[model samples]
Target: MINGAHVILYSHDAEADRAFLRDVLGQPHVDAGGGWLIVKLPPAEIAVHPTDAAQAHELYFLCDDVEGTVRELTARGVEFTEPVTDAGWGLLTRLRLPGGGEVGLYEARHQRATDL
Candidate 1:
């Protein structure tokens, strides 16, 4: 009986990144004692892709409309490092995080299992 997933983003400036997630992204979170904020993510799904390289995982935020989402986030002072590009499965872009890292944001054109 799986409950939910907890994702961690390692950052050089943990406090700044936490503020970005809490304030900038508007994610609902709770102080998990001692100021450890645990964020509640949106609906999520996983997929398996083949690769020859070492095993790695990625995190992406999904939206129904990439253009609209981009517009809104841009207004919120979020910087997008990449313009949206159609990747067959979705329209993808990278948003620059406050700690000098980037996260993936996409509007999926493919069917989502989360709707099931």
Candidate 2:
């Protein structure tokens, strides 16, 4: 049986990004070895979208309220690269990672599959 999933983010500055995930995001993690941290994520779901371009995978953090979550994260010193905007499926924005990359953040307007 499939137990769980692991998402990896390749970073130019791995340590700084790790610190952001551990300290800024306040994610619970355990050090594997040599300061490598494995983070515990909240409930997650996956979707398959048909595309004509090259195959790739993207990650997005789902929230209950985009504005509220943005405010909270801002207070914690997180930087957002974009303001939240309605995107039909959700209120979406991008948060900057310490390694100079951004990840999508959204509060979905559709039904959630987290209970599954």
Candidate 3:
């Protein structure tokens, strides 16, 4: 029986993604491999990175403020393909990673944070 899910994204630009996860998202991770650093994601942590493949995938991050999170990510030099906007479901924002993929950050007002 599966209780949780985790994903690993292969990248040629791992360092950049590593910095973005650690410095921007502030997720605690364990480092391994000298120049070949890999991050051990925290429980329930959702993360994204760049890829050369053409396949499309998505990752999500839960935030307190969608607007504030967008601002912070912008300031950090992360390019957002979609600005923060409110949909019927929740406040949503989309970002482009250096790995040629997209990640969505959402804040649901009607739903509890823990539920996400």
lDDT of 3 at 102: 70
Q: Order the numbered candidates by lDDT, best leading.
A: 2, 1, 3
- Name the candidate, 2 or 3, with the larger lDDT value: 2
- Alpha carbon RMSD to native, model 1: 0.9
Q: For each candidate, what is the lDDT? A: 0.91, 0.92, 0.71
Q: Worst lDDT window (10 residues) for model 3? A: 38-47
Off by over 4 Å in 3: 1-4, 35-57, 113-116
**Candidate with best lDDT:** 2
Query: Mind giving the per-residue lDDT tens digits that candidate 1 earns over 25-67?
Result: 9999999888888888999999999999999988899999999
What are the per-residue Cα lDDT tens digits for candidate 3 across 1-116?
Answer: 98767676665676777676777767777656564445555345433667899866666777778888788778988898986787887899888767666778888666553556
lDDT value for candidate 1? 0.91
How big is the positional error of residue 59 in model 1, measured in Å on the Cα after superposition? 0.5
